[model samples]
Target: MSTIADVARLASVAKATASRALSGKGYVSEETRERVVSAARTIGYVVSPNAASLVTGRTKSVGVIIPYISRWFFAEVLESIEQALLEQGYDMTLYNLPSASPERDRVFEYFLARKRFDGVISVGVELSDDEVDHLHRLRRPLVGIGGAIRGVHTIAIDDVATARLATEHLLSLGHRDILHIGGNQDEQMDFAVHSKRLSGFLAAMHAADLPTNDAFYACELTVPGGYEMGRSVLGDPRRRPTAIFAASDEIAIGLIVAARELGILVPSELSVIGIDGHPYAEMFRLTTLEQHPRRQGRLAVMSLLANLDIPTPEDASESTVLATNLVMRSSTSAPRAPLHHA
Candidate 1:
């Protein structure tokens, strides 16, 4: 097999310099690093992970914990993280912690305890104090995405603010009878995101002095979930809301589909808005506050890498709040002249 010594000889650099360049550890001049890499590529000199870990005390792999892999947001985030890890010459180990599963506990108590990774990126998975302590004991760099975890580096959009922005948009269009289709607060998996979003919706309504009783509908954060609830909620012409603020673009799309099935004209009869810049949002022309999950994922990986390089326990954990923007589309508009009653 082509060895580091052969690469070093070919690059005309010392073996130690070649090791530093290929391992991405100790600093080497950029020009020298490029030459070493080029020489290594030419010789097909691959660094054995086992040897690298023994020398640097780093596995060069990152652990990623997520709630649901099938969900659109989670999937997008996972893809981004994977791409970033690959670019950084790190492997990724994924742990899917489904709700109410014993496997979830095992992941924290056993799988992560194995010390297989140099760092961890948690997506939409809130770590308990004990779990955090356990990871700290492992001394692995940790970063979170989707919500804040005390003493852990985190990247998240302000869920409440995003939802409030979506709600305020409808309210600005003179929509007094606004209904919110959001995730079930009691059943949420991470950081009470559902509750935070619901709070934002309520805060907006309270600011406008609008009645909020019976204004919220809790459902799954998916298209099918929204479609099922939308059909039932939007079915009643007399009691239907004038505008609907969906917590996610997927839900908004489903609600729109439901409205069409019931022959309800959008914007003119019912306005709709949502969060998340889902791929289908543009196709559906959904008015929404766009929070990029994929970007958030990439940011989390980058943050974790930074933390890994500076392993200082005394350093205060960072909470990065990403920005979101309102994407105006055809789904939302001013309520029609008499506001269709029944």
Candidate 2:
């Protein structure tokens, strides 16, 4: 490997002059700088990134802590953020924090302490007050996605409003007895997302004076999870709700599947609405609210990068809820005249 000494000898300049020219920190004449650069290129010389970071105090990398990777929305967001970082010549180091546990402490006390990252972006997993303070002490910028932090820059859709919108869509179709197949909020140990979504469903039900009780079945936030819950809920056709609101598109797809198996045709006998424009939504011909998770990811990165240079705003620790659209599909329809009973 060619060294700085070799470049200096080839450029006919002292090592200190070559260092000044290459580092770009101190002044070097234009002609001298050009010669040093040319000599570097000729010798196929490359500066040590670690050494550069030591001098410049920048790692040019961002650390990301995400909760889940198997989910469609989160995975899409991760991919978008990765691409955006790559485009900007920044590296991303991912830390998968599946459900809050002692492992998260290791990430905070050990991994993040390395100071290898210029900033941090959290996806879906909300950080605790202590965690935020710890990062603040380290002077590392932090951005969040999925929901707002009390004092952190974040990007996400209003879960409450989005859920209410889904419910209202069914109500617009004249669905009175609506069931919400939602996540098991009680089991949500890491984040408050499930409760927020459930609250939105209840808020809409209260606004319309509808039954949002146990008929509001709890389901896993996946297609298979939704299918299992849907089968049991829809089995008793005599008690099944006229319409269903799934917390996510995955659940909605599962509900639709269960409806098919039970000989209950969608829209004709039962209507279903879901959040997220999951890829399968198109294949299953389901109605959904298209919340661009990838766009949110990119936006979070932008916000985080901005904070790396300037101190984040007082409201920077807050959240910016992105907008969504009601992407109407054939999955929703008016309740049957006689109310089809299995």
Candidate 3:
């Protein structure tokens, strides 16, 4: 097969010069680098990653740990991360496992302890102090998505503020009787996202001087879950809320489906709002807060790659909080009649 020696011979450059040109470690003239690249392509010569790692101490790969692959937000983040890594000529190793599980313990204790990657990007997986310390000891740069982690670089949105904004939007529309449909607080995802969102909703309600008793309903954080809850909650005319703030776009879409099934006109009979800029949101014309999970994923990769240059424990401790924007749509409006207690 073709080798760097062959490429160097074809380019009429010394083997050491060709090696420097291909590795990009030591400086080579721009023209010489291009000539070596052309010669390698002509000879179908490829650099051995193992050999390169032996020389540079870099695997040219990144390890990604995430909790869910089927969920929309996590899926989007994973896709973005993979794409960004590919563009940067880096390989990605994905660990799709549940949080707080025995398998997770093994991966962290055994698999990651080996340090086969140059860096790590954790999406929605809250690493413990010990785990963070382990990676630091290995001198592997770590970056997290979904929430802040002590002593780890992280990129996340302010869940509390985002949820509060969603609730406040409904309240501004004169919705005194508003119900929040979201993930179960008792069964929270990593970083207690469900609880934080619920807290935000309550904070907004209390600020508006509205009674919050029985105002929040727990669900599975999916469309089917929202449909089931909507059927029961909207079935009773006396107890029906004038507006609903869904924790996700899927739930909002499900609630709208249930409302239609019950012969209730949207925005006129009841208003609905949700988080997430899910692709279906535009189809349903749902009002929502666009959190942009893909953006977070891309940012996490960028942050990790930037730190890979320095690879210092101090540089790995930075935190970045992203912003969510409100998207106005046809799903929400002021109540058709004067607001009254349900």
Clashes of each: 0, 3, 0
lDDT of 1 at 13: 96
lDDT of 1 at 76: 96
Ranking by TM-score: 3, 1, 2
Model 3, 195-297: lDDT tens per residue? 9989999999999999999999988889999999999999999999999999999999999999999999998999999999999999999999999999999
| TM-score between candidate 3 and the true structure | 0.96
Better of 1 and 2 by lDDT: 1
* Steric clash count of candidate 1: 0
Error of 2 at 17 (Å): 8.4
Q: How accurate is candidate 3 locally (lDDT)?
A: 0.91
- Could you say which candidate leads in lDDT? 3
Query: Between which residue pairs do clashes occur in model 3?
Result: none
Cα RMSD for predicted model 1: 2.8
- lDDT order, best first, reads 3, 1, 2
* Candidate 1 residue-wise lDDT, 275-316, digit = tens: 999999999888989899889989988888888877756246
Q: Score every model by TM-score.
A: 0.91, 0.88, 0.96
Off by over 4 Å in 1: 5-21, 24-39, 339-342
